[model samples]
Target: MFCKAFRVKSHTALKSSDRKKLRGDISSTFPSLTTEKLAELMPPKEDLTIAKVFVHKGDAVSIYVHNRNPIIFELARNFYPTVYTLWRHPDLLPVFTTWPPVFERMSGGADLMLPGILMSSFGLPEVQQGTLCAITLVGNRAPVAIGVATMSTKDMLASGMKGKGFNILHTYKDQLWAYGDESCPPNIPPEEIEVAPSANLEEGYLDSESPAYITELENLHLEEVSATVQQESGEIKLSTETFQEEKAEIPYVENCNTSLQETMDDLLHQCFFHALKYKVKKSDLPLLTSAFLRNFLFACCPEGQQVDIKKSSYKKLSKFLQAMQQRNILQVKELSKGVESIVEIQWKHPDVISFVAPETVLPLETCETSDGGRKQPYQPPEILSLYGINAKMLPLFQASGHRKGDLLTANDVRSVIITYVKTNELVHSDNKNFVTVDPVICDCLLNASEKHDLLLLKWDDLVTRCLERMQPSHRVAFPGSSPVVRKGNIEAIDISVAQRGSNKKVTIIKNLELYGLDPVSVGSLLQQRVQASFSCTVLPGTKDRVQVQIQGNQVSQTGKLLLEHFKIPRKYINGLDLAGKAGKKK
Candidate 1:
């Protein structure tokens, strides 16, 4: 029949820390040492010779230690170290249990156990060492097994058993309990062994800090780049033929490695062009088209252009034709009809116009100035282009493109001696009377001239050079010659000074109080004199209103004008006063 037995548990937890206190306690209570002369009388003992090894005959071993000395604190560590080495051997490990009594003294008919007792004898001091150092084996204690290693006691003492990794040894007090003895120390617990985390967890791709390999590699690379030209070589030219051969292998490049940079310029131009279709200033539209096309061609067109016009961009544009017709946005017979009518025949734009022309007769600023002289410091093409004039007329400013000019000046700017004004002018009728228009026309230009007063600075020479020449001939004669505030046909001229040094400017052009004249024409002429400067203000009769052209060359009133016109204000003139008392003589 098999029976379960309890092997010793680990005694590493014994906590030898109380040894000092225990020593103090023992010294205070126990009597001082007295060497028993009897230890000297019993002559030196012979070698330990076991006649019969009675190890665990039933439960425990019986042995005698001759002339054992008293235990003391001075030699405790040296004494304890030898006993601790016993359990290092596998063969001696099983038998070691609790601390064996150093000496069992008979006192008052009771057995007294004296532990950690130092003794003097051949096998005594070395009882925990040598071949006797093996621990007692103790699985089944009925017949305990005695552990042994085939080596001399001295050899065993000199070379202690090698440790079994985390395994622990056992001893009794300061003496290692021999293998044949009954005492055994407890075994250590499993929880005391702890395992660390794996190496992969400590070193991972997404960790806060990168792996060592990359950092070290980058540092090595920078070192190489910085040492491109060493001090040992005094001078070097990268462009030399030999160097060039080496450099060619290095592969010089200009951002060719960048992703999609080559197409960015064209893409940007296309976006701007497509966006321009929604809303843009009338004046700016032509300039926008010019800028877009010029930059676009420079950016997108392959150099050394060989454009076959019919085939160029035809395929890309052609695809949209079918999509347009099938939707029936506009009903059409077929793709051919749509293409022929819309795309091929009438879709003309001057974007493709060339620069060169013959017999176009370009402009020269000095156009036979009576004595034939030239005017230097010519204005740029944009000045002439503002009025929608042809570019060929301006020799100085034109870059062979469309141009516009102020018709008032260019036609009459020449220096000529003419003493008389044209007697029959638009303002001067055949009978020399002021031309009368629907009074509303005068009201409209005065109403529109209100967009002024944002001005912080004033030009001292408010009248233009061209107008100054015409002033002598037309200031007292024509409305255009008078200084006025203007926005196209809308104007405020014939300004009545509010008060002396009033600092007020341009109230109304050709007010009803004055004789007839169109303020729009006057204001336009005045605006021409100042180039294209404008100011912002609101007139007395108008509030948050402006004259915007509704139809071609014609404008409509808005805001307060609409309100005031519909509701005519009743005029009340206080009756003149009559003095009655002073008239008694009458």
Candidate 2:
């Protein structure tokens, strides 16, 4: 069961009688479970709750302790009675052991494959198919995953221990584990766990299985099954067939520098023409420049290929679109500064009208490989010395016991202001929002008029002016990457579309508060402008600010509304370049 969805379902507290019945059920499911052990583990009282949760393809009721940690549960149709038993206590249940690598795979939502299982020296667990089993790692002996056996032990041996052996229900480190307090598996050394000699009988058995082994085994199996065909076939035919299949599936480009440039050019050309002919429609014209580039043009690039504008002959997407306009293929117009929108298109442009896409066009390959072999190691950005702090601002730092030559970071400046405010008891008694600015703070931070008169300043304004006075220092050390420097007093706005249930798109607009805009008012305006459903959801960890979400791909309409109606500057909206284009109706 995925833990995230389980947490979302409505949980109701179990009644006293119901809790008693549940205790009885658990004892019946696990016969060895004693009354004393059950009392310690599953307490009868104290707010026990149950929620019907969807587990994989089936429904299961999750029993939670104090509506927090999900300890035990049973799937639909009883599912072999309590399909999973959690390891919240230190007791050995019927556990099947595997290697550490397999434990990692199971944690990542992968089923336990037969090949990943490590049989005990004595024999595999004598369990029937669909039996609930605990999967423990070889070294740790601590159960990491719980699931139902897909095959009986006899059936597993008969089939050579191949295919999926366990259908994992819940695993450690999964979403469910994240819901409760962060609890980790106990650390048990390999020497502590007992194993029979037969466990060590298979050579290299303990070593993690590789993808190459699966491929080799498949080829060997194929050869054995079709011995006659293999004898008749030449090595050239087999090799060529394999190469052709690989090429058809994976578009590989030559690694040579010269070929790289040419290949990129061809790939861009292919993507441009393909998008223009198939993806873009005349009805969808008057599209926002950001929306067109992000959703249509950029999305057209072959999967796995990095869409770098520098690699193309044109250095910018706008320049490339302008080139297309010059060729009479389309037309572009500047609506505002740095904001361009497509105004016209030549539906019957000669080149586009007669174009026929190649049946087997190879996609452009990326510089890095799937195995991350050619990837470059991460290099931290260079730290450069900033300009030294001004002498006039020295008192602000000095008042806080900071020496004249003491180096101050952006955080240090804020700290000094906070310390000064708290020490002087400047905060208003009734309303803490107001800070009574003293003559010392006024002289060092505020303007001349403000210093002349005693004034009540907002806490945020005090912090902002404090940061503004400190100049960048010349001496530099690589303590860490410098904080992001805001270009202006106004914060940048961002608009992005996220996929929701069943591929439905929701466009999210953030940082409206930065522009002194009310999220509720903006949300209302969006609904009116687009004539679509929209809502204002409060952003987490923020006081009153919220994010505006509009249903479907509404970036084009949202940008137009912001620019023409809202009068928001083009530069302030940061992620318009990532706005999605509206999909063509079928």
Best by lDDT: 2
Cα distance off (Å), candidate 1, residue 192: 57
In each prediction, how many residue pairs overlap at the backbone (N, C-alpha, C within less than 3 A)?
27, 4
List lDDT for all candidates, in order.
0.23, 0.58
Q: Model 1, clash count?
A: 27
Model 1: per-residue lDDT, tens digit, 225-336?
2212111222211111222234335322221233232233333323322323322233432232223332222223222111121222323323333443453322222333
What's the TM-score of each model vs. the native?
0.14, 0.35
* Each candidate: RMSD: 50.0, 28.1
Question: What would the per-residue lDDT of candidate 2 be over residues 506-546, giving only the tens digit for each residue?
Answer: 88898875554445445644554454566556567775457
In model 1, which range of ten residues has the least summed lDDT?
1-10
Where in model 2 is the C-alpha error above 4 Å?
55-60, 77-85, 88-92, 188-204, 207-586
